[model samples]
Target chain A: MKRRTALKVAASAALTSVLTIGSAYGAEPIRFGAVAPKTGALAAGAAITHWPNIQLWVHQVNERGGLRMKDGSRRKVEIIEYDDRTNPGETIKAVERLATQDKVDFIVAPYSTGLNVAAAPVFAKLGYPQVAATAITDKIPELTQRYPSIFFALGSTTALASSVADVLAKMKAEGKIGNRIAMVNVADAFGIELAEASRPIFVKAGFEIVFNRSYPLGTQDLSPIVKGAKASNPDAFVAWSYPPDTFALTEQSKIEGLNVKAYYTAVATAFPAYGGKFGKSVEGHLGAGGVNTDTAEMKAYFAAHQKVTGKPADYWASAVTYASLQVLEQSIEAVGTDRKAVIEHISKSTFQTVMGPWKFVNQSIDKVWTVGQWQGGVFHGVASTGLPGAKPVIVKTGW
Target chain B: MTARETRTLILVVVAFALLACLPLLRHGYLLSLGVDIAMYTVLATSWALFSGPTHYISLATAAFYGIGAYVVAAGIGTLPYPALVALAGLAGAVAAALVGLATLRLSGVYFVIFTLGLAELVRQIVTWVQNNFTGSRGMYVLTSITERMIYWELLALAAAVFFIGWRVARSRLGFALRIIGNDETVAAHLGINSAACKLALFVISGAFAGMVGAIMAPRLSYIEPSIAFTSELSFQVVIMALLGGVHRLWGPLVGVIPFTILWEVIAARFPTQTVLLLGIAFLLIVYLIPNGVVGRIESALRAAQRRVSHA
Candidate 1:
């Protein structure tokens, strides 16, 4: 009887100890939901630009004892992801699932501008702060009015267009290139907005658009377009393109020898693969985004990104995405998952990130990293409206 | 009613009753999935209604669906959603009748090619109109209804399509269509107005597809020409109908549910290789079961019953 009573007491003690330990250490993970194009047409780009960055951010955060809460407790991040399949309907459904089904604490934005715009209203309605890292649009005033929680991390269409025009204008003045330019844009929203914005800017800068064209998305053959641009005999070529078209246009340009003094392609030109693909030919090639790899923090980030993701980060939005996550983390840590507090903190506070000191102004990125040119196998910032410390523009070499 | 008819009615009633209670469970993901499944079921079933009966491999589903989506896009604020849905159906019926009058006489591969071309033509036209006239890339739809409401509406549409299918299958029109599918020349000689029957069925199928597209537009909250007119939608509905056994009324329901679940599961688990995996699975299923899942099941059950009778 006495032995039985002792066993019961020991069992009770063990149960109490287990409960205490569980309460102290095993807090529920803060779930972060992300919808990216895991399949369909945009899968290749998403693999490099979207998913890897999120995975790396989560891994790095968990490695450093997770996010610190205001209650002096650390909670690891658990990511719940859905493949948007590069469709707006799928994106909306995925966002709904993330918000209602998974009941996630936070949501990271989808990949492209169209998708981000499609999802913005849903995110706003659901009261989630959407930090759109790759979305480029001129509808900032309207979008902000419609959804205050929506923030644009990428440069606006005007910012990107004007920056490219300024570089071209400088080249024309320096006698590096002529005033005649050829421009082609993808027929989607992103390319359309950029094309429309850049047309007026280029005209104002005294550059004549000798050849202007718009091609549909998922276009397989850019040979005809590149051939047309070459036939125009323009001094510079500008393509507002997505990832696949960017690569295709560059390849076709090389094959067709559509070489110009100023060659610019948007969206994926800052990709490390772009430099790796063309080797020395990529030097002086201008693209959408640029990074100042000279900063100490940038150097460390590059190294860590490679180590963590087992892949080199792209020059364009990789750092930007990581910076957005940094803002989210700092905000969460500062305000402890009180969503209102987190949103308030994100809007008000300046967080140091891999992209250096970052803050949102008027629900949009105040600073723009608009144009980058490949020089010696590295993408270097060439022109920006707000960002300082840009490298001097160099004339592109002939293919 | 006969025992078999009464039993079928009871089963359908029970299934619908169960379906109607689904939203009450408050499974948000399941409700969303149900909406997708119901939309596909409507598409597949409606396609089967015409293509299965007439043996006309119509690839014009996207054309009608896109037309309906555009109707909603152009008239979202001008009329009520239910009225827009009906208008979309009317528009689809009219378009299908016009196309049917033009091409219903063509047979076999010619009919297939014409319908495929028709879809592409409509897609290009919509794209052009959207780019030039709309001055908008995509239109935003304003909807205050819940997902559950959308699901119920889709479910009701699917049920209505099923009822219409049942009524048609039992009518003299259904007899003529079956005969026409078997041998068009023989059916014509039997005093059946083959052209009229085919045109009517085609219009009905197109109208149902249009209704689905209209109802689904607001749920998406945005519609663009590319999204609305994608050939993938047409191809998916065809594949689902074929995979479920186009001959049976419940075949599409059987095919769509499993296919959607599999797609969602595979897509979520293997995002990079989803297309590859789905392709492999599709090939295996088509090769293994040429008549589809429902057809194979029916064959197996009949074989077993025959064996028992012989015993």
Candidate 2:
């Protein structure tokens, strides 16, 4: 009995030792938590513009045998994802759970301005360098001034808003567009802000606002509004819309045959499905864009994105996500595992990403804004004039 | 406490202790799970108050919950965190009481519509406030979030909500609510003052939801129209209460824990199929387990005891 007991004890000890060494051999994987609206109203936009770049980065990094860690070792990057159901409260709760509960080394948030706003303070407080991919509002920079840890990937709204006016001016000077303009805005925070900012600039540049209307944000039917626009007989129709609202308004406008002279929208203008949905109808449709189609680097990125995701990758927000990822990698490379150090580095340093280069100018530097518009199925960079192959597309009036 | 009461208390205490230790467990993932459960626990218990007692379906709980949250965000500049949270609860209670007075006259479906109207109104008000307060830029609390702080705060709020539920269940108010629940007209005939009781219940329940909102708003560090108030949230609370068992004291906790875990699992595992599955599961629960899992379990146990005694 004593001999049998000794043998069993020895066997147990051996098993424990083996388990300990096995755990030691397996280095802990670096986990990054991503939260986005996988369902609900935001899902369609998220599927097209937001999710693929994350999967792209994950696959690319993993293909190279994962990220190189500080200890001269490589660990696979594990992504723990949650669908926020397009609810801000749920997104906030998910982000908190992901940060504090999941204890992810990094976090990638969704493309909603409201959701990003909800998560910014959480990420900043935890000292996590959150790459807020698509959602860009003027409020982000103001928040960044107070909390230096949060950095925005997308171009500031102030730039896009005023630049739309500048783009209209350039088109008007070319004698390709009419003098009359009309505005229709969704009555949400983001839409309202964009419309308000774009209005003064549009007026200052000699564009007349003939008809203006603000509909409630979730108004599913826009035929009445579009019919009213048709009655006004404006040359250009400028709409400030959310993603779902964009599709609804655009589809309804087409149905009503209220094409007018030029059709333009904000938010999901650069979506591939938008083009695929309308075909020729969307060819001349204009909106905000971040990158140009002709750039070799952008082309390569899109090609890679298409190869990996099996979906066309040419939206403005995805460019922002791609740029944010580049910035994140650069920050991690500079600061190594220290989150505070990374935040400080980002605050002080100008990092080169796919968005050309971004420097954290004084929280007051609102002048370096940019805007882009689509023409012939390609988005043309309009503002900040030095970009290559960025000749302005002037819209000629039928009236 | 009696033997049965003592055993129940011990079980509850042990469960809470496990929750408290979860943040310090092997991974932060577990901590997040704990936070989700804790938040649901608060929401579930508050939802149970009106649904279980008076049977007056207050779908406007989400509105009050959101009001409490935004009030905290709006008051953060002026009030301390604890005071701000308390004030939010006070505000929610007042709003609930006022709403109860207006709608308590209705019954069944009409009551449901009245509450729905209140929720829609609250959503509109939230949008208007966001537009005015933040200059049409979404209202974001310009602050950083700390995990440990929010975890502890949520835990405290959860405890406070459960405590309120426990006190109400054990007090004279419980008997009054039970009478009202059997039939409001009959309860009023017995001088139960159904309107007064409902208003008080609304105030109490609204305060619990408000407390949760106050704690959660600061954690998110941002608030907007859709974030603070949504019909979906009201439905979630109601579902949680139904899953737990409407009349039973322990139903909310039972419902919240399993529902939250299942919700996370579905989200993490299936990702795309979660909503469809949740809908299907809700349908099944409504059909298969009408009184909820806990209520069914209790009934089964009682029948088994009777069989054993007869034998």
Candidate 3:
């Protein structure tokens, strides 16, 4: 009897879920789908950098009575979301499902470089335009050639690597730093690509790489890496790292007192939490991605993002991520919900975004904020690929 | 085979034939889920072939799977797809045989720990090799293999694995392994070559896992050590096998089907809360169905039969 009751309840619960999933919504809202690593090792970072921005975009669009269609009818957004759990297999399956089953009008690309690459084929096959805002790979030319619909907004590994190299070289010329350098990278796709790109560029810039090493991703003990970099006594230190490792490496550097005039780290160094945690000590600390937070456009974007999501946007790719969405929105509005039309429209157009008036040449954004520094409690864009209104780099005189 | 066994075999074939026709429907989502279902079916069923009767509890599924993915990543353009898959299977078998010979001596927890460590070791080796030899840490398997093709490959592999499992369950080797699982010393005393039996089955399991990995690689497109050799996959397979009652030949399927669907639903319904819900769901499954769905059904049937007989 007890078992029968349990069975009855289970059956009804399953039935309800099926109904809810199959239920139609009002207003014929334009369906936007996204598969994010919401429940994995990358979840925490995605929470801050990826998911919140997506929500903010949705909220803003819906508040403005959705996207304006060509017929002047407004279509609100209804999101079909999936937690990828950070598995590539799961990521692929979720994207495929969104494309085929849910049949969403638009699909947002997954977070991080690896996942974006993993699901690119699915996006191509399903005729969805994958706006890969967070993906940073040097294989942009090849990828763009292959997947014509997929757009990479974040600058390439080569672009970023050269920027770091350029920043260090500029400092050396000013006698702020020397030619000797210490470098470490997280041994994953993102870090490895950057490191490989930088090696040739750094050599060409007449800088001797005094120390170079790579630690595996998710490695907890970073003291050895920090100590090793310090032992070389290099004038500049750079770590092409992921979020957790970036924080860990910075903490270890502070603990070990590994002083280098032009210290640079990647990924999470632009995070607001990084600023909140280290406070004044992070002033002049260089990192990946610089934004002119002082710009009125940027100021408004920041305000809207914080107001909607109740979280501050990161200094680097948050705006970039939001900008990719803006590009998608503009394309969709112009071309309607037809996937091919949007892709073609996006390929040949310029978009006014939070990151400024952006254009995709060869389906890739060329200009990007490659290096940023903390100045007066704000991560300011110190250098870029000639993005308008970038600030000058500030030297790290102390911890 | 007995008539009963023949009927079961026919049913299996009919099911396979129906599943083979899924691509014709061209429902992209169903086919995608089919690929997942078939992949896990292959992994869990093949896993049951060795770990079921043997009870060795090997946690090295990802090692063989990663090896298969890497094999495809390394050989995608140069070699034909089928040949790459075959080579991956062979590679997995060879690796398993080597590991089994060395570590199969240690039973229970010791073997589990060693097997868990094996995937990490292989991943590091792959990462090092890629760093030193290949210019990139990750490789792209840029083939025009469609999702339908991947699903079919996995479905065929699942059928082959299940057929092998059925045969192994009724074979002399199966009898010996069951005894070994019960008591290794007693099995040896009973004139069973326990080590050899365990090693043979382990190779078969690893081979299937590797084949599944190779077939699924194109769907992934991007191949890196971390993506290929996620340790979570190993644990998931184990949990699935346990949930379905690994002792039965077709038990893992019962576990895989529901788990995969439930996972999708939970992930969809509660995107942010899914992780917490997943943990809760697993705890509930383990607690409520400790003996597994198959075991519970078998026991209930036995009880009903006894009641009817008494009447």
TM-score of 1: 0.85
Stronger candidate by TM-score (2 vs 3): 3
Candidate 1 chain A, which ten residues in sequence have the lowest lDDT sum?
Answer: A18-27
Worst 10 residues of 2 chain A by lDDT: A360-369
Preferred candidate (lDDT higher): 1 or 2: 1
Best by lDDT: 3
Error of 3 at A398 (Å): 1.3
Pairs of colliding residues, candidate 1: none
Q: Can you tell me which runs of candidate 1 are displaced by over 4 Å?
A: A1-28, A96-103, A121-127, A147-149, A169-178, A204-206, A216-221, B1-26, B74-87, B94-125, B128-146, B222-226, B267-273, B287-311
The digit string of per-residue lDDT tens for model 2 on B110-211 reads 988888778778877666554444446545555444555567777877777777778888888888899989887788888888888778878888888888
- The docking category that best describes candidate 1 is acceptable
lDDT of 1 by residue, A293-370 (tens): 888988898898899889999998888988888889999999987776777788888888888788888888778688
Best by DockQ: 3
Q: TM-scores, in order shown?
A: 0.85, 0.82, 0.93
lDDT of model 1 at residue A366? 72
Report how closely model 3 matches the true complex, as a DockQ value: 0.53
- lDDT, ranked from best to worst: 3, 1, 2
In the range A1-399, model 3's lDDT, one tens digit per residue, is 999999999999999996675455445788899998877777887888899889999999989988998888888888878989888778888887788777788989899887998888878878899999998887788888888779999988778889999999999999888999999998876777788889889999999999999998789999999999999999999999988898999899999999889889998999999999988889889999978898788999999988988989999889989999999899988989999999999999999999889999899999899999999999998788888787777778777
lDDT of each: 0.85, 0.74, 0.88
